[model samples]
Target chain A: MDLLRFITAGSVDDGKSTLIGRLLYDSKSILADQLAALEKQSKNKEDGEIDLALLTDGLRAEREQGITIDVAYKYFSTPRRKFIIADAPGHIQYTRNMVTGASNASLIIILVDARNGVVEQTRRHSIIASLLNIPHVVVAINKMDLVDYSQDRYNNIVIDYAEIARTLGLKDVTYLPISALKGDNIVEKSTSIPWYEGPALLELLETVQLEKDIDLERGRLGVQYVIRPQSNDLDLHDYRGYAGKIASGIYRKGDKITVLPAGLTSRIKTIEVGGKEVDEAFAPQSVVVQLEDDIDISRGDLLVNGDHLPQVEQEFEVLLCWMDTKTLAAGNKYLVQLGSRTVRGLVKEIEYKVDVNTLERQPAPAQVGLNDIVKATIRTATPLPFDRYTDLSVGGGVILIDETSYVTVGACMVQ
Target chain B: MSKEHNYQLDYLDQLESEAIHILREVAGQFERPALLFSGGKDSITLVHLALKAFRPGKFPFPLVHIDTGHNFPEALDFRDALADSIGEKLIVRKVEDTIQKRQLTEPGGKFASRNALQTFTLLDTIEEFGFDACIGGARRDEEKARAKERIFSVRDEFGGWDPKRQRPELWNIYNGRIRKGENVRAFPISNWTELDIWNYIRREKIDLPSIYFSHDREVIDFEGQWVAVSPFIRLDATDVVETRRVRYRTVGDMTCTAAVESSASGIDDIIREITATRTSERGETRIDDKVSEAAMEDRKKNGYF
Candidate 1:
């Protein structure tokens, strides 16, 4: 079976944790001991009913506050696919946590309360899904039981969200109506909503098309580390290999390649995956490639097919997400790490900050604080090969680390 | 999609590649790194991945083990043999020596566990070598607190983990940058579950310690779980020691780690047993975590790996 990584975003009032708990419970992923523990904790509730939301609130503070503070990863598998859920908090202040969770997700499940259809929280989450370039979107309208399982309510919500989808330029959006608390339209088709003809949430998750997400056209590999035995043995003497995971596309033995920044050309002599020689290697596969000629390739160097080379420049524009408590201003210097390369970078200028809730480009702020997303220009000390975040996320996403504190302060997506 | 263009990988391959990538990041970023080895199935799987990651070349870091002295003889024997077979450097530090030097008080109970004291020796070892990063076999599916941990979890100089201060880990990029005195605990297999590890082991044909398989042992029943009767625990007169065919699901200090009654003698049987089991890996085997709901989280905040 294959794997699917997704994120669930909704505020505490929208039943985000309840949806995840229901997914695990209905899929039989929760064991007997875990259920017993949940039952014990549910006694403290006012209603004396089992609170499934207790499953994802792992931290003590989160349990006390009855809210998700940070992103917690949960795992479950079915016959066809293995699922990794990044359950992130949806409060306004927790936008950074949501971005961190949505960065690696191929799909996103945005929960919208049926009582309040297409509210501000829903728009904010959709904006993030678009910013991170999530391929699939599942807008689960939760709490249909409260709405009396009315088909008209579901249709109105879908119509309201279609406008937001268009304004944000979100593609491949899917809508579903369900009651996460009452177990309606989750694992099994609900008899209550007979007018709805769509499959259950579990079936849609299993059958989502993800193979097209992997780009096999432009092969890219960033050299993470070089392996050299340098031993005196006759068979092992003078062996060197460039080791990294293919950022995108496919590579084969005898293929002509070029090392970026230096623009050195060579032919692939051999390809090894898991220490075994393979004829060809594709995207996302970690392999060791040996060049026919001895070239001075080191870490931070990019290798790509000779035909399609990424842009190598020292200056670029990016949408920066400030993550640290310290404010960021123009002329601030930090370490920018893109893929395997880390270089000195300066925030040249802050053009404008995008209002997440309204999707409007506001005036440039003098200083950007935590959870602020801004469009800015950055200049690196050395030329680096990179693609746009919209085109190839693996090569374009970067993180900024503080010089003295050594903390990751910002996440930048190349525009 | 075309027939020859079937570029999809099995779940195992995807997990393996991701792990190797993280391992390589540690090698590329840290000036001095070490792999925390405990002679368990998870760490053994890590060793296998390390071999695949840096074969035909020596590993960038040595294998370090903080011996709690309360370990089973079988696991210690296997630890020595595995390091010897790989022809790599293995550094062993004893918690017994730390307790003696520091004059620390040991917990007194029927099951006196040294699991908590392993952190002191680990911190001392880190200081002695100035290791900038230590790769472990911790998986998120094992516990709730671990599920929120990052792949490159940054620790303070005293080796404390602050969950709220975790760096934003995006895509496959990991930030291994830390201050001089601080170190990172890198978990390459953070995404792998217990079932994933077993399936990977079965596919790779990786050899493990004999305790992982079924064998006849004298065990004591504690709170509906089977605890091995070893010299580390206090045996009372009222306690009944019976011979039962059992195997360990997790390897830790002999006093804290429990065993399950099973007849799974091979990898296939163990996989089948785990598939049909109702309890989690930690729920079934780890007795130390039953102290409270946030037991693991509390320990992790105080520098317990």
Candidate 2:
């Protein structure tokens, strides 16, 4: 079965964990032992109700404080598809965590409580999903039970979310009205809302079109590890291979390729999967690419089709999200890790800080602190190969680390 | 749609790419690294990913297995054979050896298991070799604490994991940088679920320990689960041993690893069983996790892989 990776974003009381638990519980994904354990850990035994929030609240602090501070990954499967859920906590200070969780997600579920429609956090999450280029969005209007499963309430909230999604340029938005606590529209259709005719949340998740999300133009492969045989082993004696996952596009043997930053050229002599030789490899396949000529390539080097070369620049602009407690100031040195490459870099300029909820800009911000998303220019000590985030996302994502603390302090999208 | 641009990747391919990328990072980032191989299906899959990451070449890192001295004989045999076949250096640090050095003391009882003591040997071996990175096969779907883990997790000088202080991994760009006296525990297959592993194993045709396949084994019913009677496990007078067609969902030290009643003779059969499995791989097999709800979490925070 194929995989669909999605993220769920909502405020602490939006029932993010409850929604996930309902999906798992209703689908029979939660095992007997797990359910038993959940019962044992239930805080309300007198009511004979199992606390679903305690399932994802694995951390002691999260259980005691009744809030998720970090990204919690969850996995489940139905017959049609397997799922990987990156459940990001929707808090203003934890914006970095949401970005981290949604970075690789193909789809995002922005939960909006029916009791409080069109909240600031909802807009913030939608903006992040759009900025991250998530291919799909689900504006799940949750807690319909409180609204008496009212059709007008659900429709009105969806209309509000639709305007925000359109303004943010979010693609493929789907809306669902559900009561996570009562399992309404979660696994089975809720008869209480007879006006609704959409598929259940589980059905939609299992049948979503996630395959078309990958970009397959301009073959890009960052040389992560240059494989050379230790000895005259088997049939691969003296064989040298450029090993990495195809970032995008399709590549084949005999295709002429260019080595970025070095401006050297070579032909793809062989493509092997470590099991056997193959004629061609496409985007996201981790295969060994052997060149006709022994070119000088190492980790951090990029190999692309000669016809499709990415920008090799020492200075570039990025939409940066500062993730550390330490404020980021201009002229402060840091390390930029982009794909397989890590190079020393410094902030050239801070263009602006974005207020995601209002879509306003704090122009020429003097400094950026924890969870602040800003636009900035950076100059690296050496040239690196990268694409614009819109054209090719896998190659454009970068992370900034502190020089001394060795902490990933920021995430950058090459602009 | 043109086939050229419409080449969609299956979930397995995507997971493979992820695992390969992590293995490459381990090779590119660290000075001294090793893969923690338990000879289980997860570790076996990890070895294959590392092999693909640096094939036609010897792995830059060695295979490090913290032998708990009570491992299944088949697991050790497979581990040694795999290391030899790949021509990679294999390092074995035994809990028994650590016990002899007085660095660890064995628990005494009918229910005593050495599974928890493997951590002491592991930390000692890591310090001895000064390996900056330890690639493991710990998946998040197995337990609760693992669900919130970063792909590249940081450990302190004492080898303790501080979950609250973990470095955030934003995307494919993993920060493998750590200071001296500190190390990183990398989990490439963190996103892969139990079914995903079984499917990938079938796809790749990876050879696993024979214990994973169903066979007649002498097992005793212990607390509603079947525990294989082995030399390492001393049974009580009340324990009754009987032959059963069983297979292990997870392979660890024989003393603590339980088996499930099954007729899954091959990968396809195993996949079907796993597809309909009610309990998780560890939930059904690992006795160590039965100690407490946060057993794995406590062990992980204490530097156990």
Candidate 3:
């Protein structure tokens, strides 16, 4: 079985927690002791109907206020695959949390209440999903039982979302109708919605084609550490291995490679994955590579196949998401970290901010506040090798860190 | 190499790769780091992963253990033996020494657990060594509060965790940058579940202490749980101690970590039993977590691992 990481985005009243709870409940992932605790807590509430939302509200303040503040991760597995759910809060102020959750998700489930067909919150979530370039999208029209499982309502909502998807250029979009409160169309097919001919939510999650999502032609590896064992043994005198995770594509023994920024050339002498020597290694695999030529390589240096070298420049454009409380302005200096490299960077200019609700580009703002997405130009102190975020997320995504406070302040997708 | 080769990794492989990446980050970012080892299955699995992560070269960080003095003898022996066999540095700091040196009052109860006192010794060790990061084996699947924590959790000078002030972690890029006197608690295996750990251990053929397997031991019944009859706990007049075949699901201070009645003698049997069990790992074994609803959360806020 493989693993799939996903995120669920919706408003507080859209039954996002209930849907997650139902999926875990129907899949038998909730154990007896946990259920007993939930039952006991449910009794203290007014509804007293085994509030599944209690399972995801982890923080004490969240439980008291009946709102999710930060991103909470949930896990469940089936015979075919295992899943990691990033249950992020759905509030205008909490967009940073959603962006943080969506940064690593392979798929996204945007919940739309059947009673309210299409709203600004739905549009905002779709825009964020589009901005993050999530590989798959599932528009779950929830609360169908409350609407008497009306096929027409589902169709209308799907039609509305299709227009938004087209505007945002979302790919691999899927639609489904379900009632989380009544456990319909979650783990198993809902007999009530016979007109909707699609696999259940769990089935789609299990069988989603994720193999094609990986870019195998452009291999990239950022050297995080160098493994050198200068031991007294006969075979360990002069071993220098560049250690890193294959960001994309594959590396084989004897393959011609280049160390970026420095522009040094070398041939792959050997590849080892998990300490076991292998002939070839692919993306997402943490491996150690030895070069035939002795080169000065260290952390923050990029290694790639010579044929598919990334852009090497000192300045680039990025879509920056402000996550810090302090406003982001032009000429602000911060540490820009891409892959394993950290360099001093300056925000040269802010072109405009994208209205998350409507995909329109607003005029350049004097200052960018928290949760604002803006297109900006950044100039690094040193040249770096990177790919466009739309092409290779692992190599292109960068985080801006506050130099004095030592906090991550912004997330930038290299343009 | 063929261009059409299948590139999909197994679930365990993916988890392993992710963990290795995190470990390498710790090695690359922190100036002074240490791996928190407790000789439990989780920490043991972490040691195994560290081997895979830094083999052919010495581990950049040492294996550090916070000895609670209430630990089982079997686990302590195993911890020393494993460290010795691997030829790694092991630094041990005792909570007993901290309690005596600091003149702290111990909790009074039938099961007087030193689990909370562990934080004091751990913080003291961090200060003593000037460690900028502590790599732990905490998994999000173990508790609700842990589920909300980030892979690179930052703590103040007092070792306090403020949930509201947590920085947003995006993508695989972790910000290990911290001010002086502040340290980060990095969890490499934050996403693995209990069953996943067992499956990985079985596939990797890792060795464990004999206490993980079924054995005859003297245990006392306490609130529908089985507590081992060790010198750390007080025996009452009504308390009856009996011999029962049991195995531990989690390994902690013997005064607090309970045992479950089981006859599973091998990893396969243990995996099968865990698959069929209804109770959660901490719910079945950890007596300390039963104190209140936000037990783990409160402990984490005050700097408990």
Candidate 4:
């Protein structure tokens, strides 16, 4: 089955957990024992009702304090696609967690409570999703039951969020009116809102085009490892194949490819997966590629089609999100993990701060603090093959590390 | 050594490759490294990937198992057999030994699980072995506290985790650094979820302990969880006894590891059941985590794996 990984974002108490619980319960995803446990916990509740939130709130403190402290991943599958949901904490303190969860998500579902049409948290999450380059932005206006499932109330939220979506360069903006508490537009269509005509949340999830969302035509193949058999058997002896997953783009046997770092050129002899040879390989495929000649290739090398090579540079500008408690100051050094390669980089300059709410770029900032978004210039110790993050997110990003502490301090999106 | 042949790789393959890359970097970055293998499916998968990463050569690091002394027999047997098959060095440290040395003690009865006590043994092992990096198969989906952890989580000399001061991890780059006597608990599978582990095992055709598959076992009711009726469990009068066909989704201390009633005798059956189950795999088995709201966070801060 095809995989569709998505991230959910909302402010605390916006019913994000409840919505997830409803989807799981309505889909018959809850096991018999799990439901029994939920029922048992509900009986002892101060308010007597099945606290559906308990299904996702697995932490003990979360149950007592009634708040999510960190991201919680939940998974479920429809026949058409298997979904992995990264349910991120919505508190301002946990903005780093939201970015981590949505970094690789194919779709981002931004939950907005209809009672409060547009809040700071909604805008923050929308900006983060857009900044992360999540292709599909789903605006789920939850708690429509409180508004009596009124189309006007739902439309107001859609319009308010639409403006933000457009500003963020989110091309695929989908608005769904869902009431997680009453099971409206979550799993089944709610007859109460007959004026609305759209597919249920599950159907939309099943039919969403995720394969096309990833740009296949534009990406460099980063070689992560070389797989060779060490034995002296006749069939397995003297084997040397460049083994690494294609970080991006497609590779054909006859295609002329350039190996970066080594600066050598060769034609693809063949592609092997689990010892079987194939004709073609694409982005994110962990296969072993054989070159026609004995080219010098090892780990941490970039392989690109000769026709389209990524920029090999030592200096680049990037939009960075500071995640560590230690602020980013000039002249600080870090270990950058870009694709399969690790290179040392120094902070050159902080250009300007991004106003998430206003979608405006403010004047140049002196330093970037925790949760600050700014454009900055970096100088790497070695040339790295990369593209603009907007075109190739997998190959164009780097995580900054504190040289002294060795912790990841921030995430950088190459411009 | 086979030639570069054509093949098709999936998402799981990509995840595995990323994990292998991290493993190689850990080996190169740290002076002395060890794998915290619990014989669980996730850790087992880590071992498999490590073998793939450094194939044609022996693994550079050894495997360590912090035995709580209150473990299922199947788990112990599986751990030894797996290590023997791979010809890799295996080190077993027991919490009971630490207690005997008067380093620590619990007020509870002998039947009480040594789950918490294992932390002392683990830290001692790290100190004794002078390991700078320890690889584990902790996934973010297991609990909320883990969800916030970095791929390379640094622990102080006291082995305490400072949540507020964790290093940031961006893209695929992992940072593994520590001062003298300080160690890092590396989780190569931090981004992987419970479903991903199972799917990888299925795709790779890796073997696991029999407990992971369904089987008939003697069990007793302990609070709301199903406890394996082993000699370690002190059953009360109200505790009902039953023989149920069940399997363990997680293998921790036998005293706290609950069993789920299942007839999933194979990987395909288990996969189907997991797909349909709404509750998380961790929720089905872990009793320690159900204790308090901040159970995982507190334990993590205290350096409990």
lDDT per residue (tens digit) for residues A243-325 in model 4:
66566677788888888866788888887654468887776665677888887787789888746678889999999888887
User: What is the Å distance of residue A111 in model 1 from its true position?
Assistant: 0.6
Query: What TM-score would you report for chain A in candidate 1?
Result: 0.98
How should the candidates be ordered by DockQ, best one leading? 3, 1, 2, 4
Q: Considering only N, C-alpha and C atoms within 3 Å, which residue pairs clash in candidate 3?
A: none
Q: Each prediction's TM-score against the native?
A: 0.99, 0.96, 0.99, 0.87
Off by over 4 Å in 2: A45-47, A233-237, A306-308, B1-5
Better of 1 and 4 by lDDT: 1
Superposition error at A287 for model 1 (Å): 0.6
Candidate 4 reaches a DockQ of 0.31
lDDT by residue (tens digit), candidate 3, A283-333? 889999999999999999999974877999899999999999999999999
* lDDT score, candidate 3: 0.93
For candidate 3 chain B, the 10 contiguous residues with the lowest summed lDDT are: B1-10
Tell me the DockQ of each model, to 2 decimals. Answer: 0.83, 0.71, 0.88, 0.31
- lDDT tens digits by residue: candidate 3, B1-305: 24576888899999999999999999999999999999999999999998988899999999999999999899999999999999999999999999999998898899999999999999999999999999999999999999999999999988889999999999999899999888999999999999999999999999999899999999999999999999899999999999999999999999999999999999999999999999999999999998788999999999987
Expressed as tens digits, the lDDT of each residue in A15-90 for candidate 1 is 8888899999999999888888899888456566678899998898899889898999999999999999999999
> What is each model's TM-score for chain A?
0.98, 0.97, 0.98, 0.95
Candidate 1 runs further than 4 Å off: A43-48, B1-3
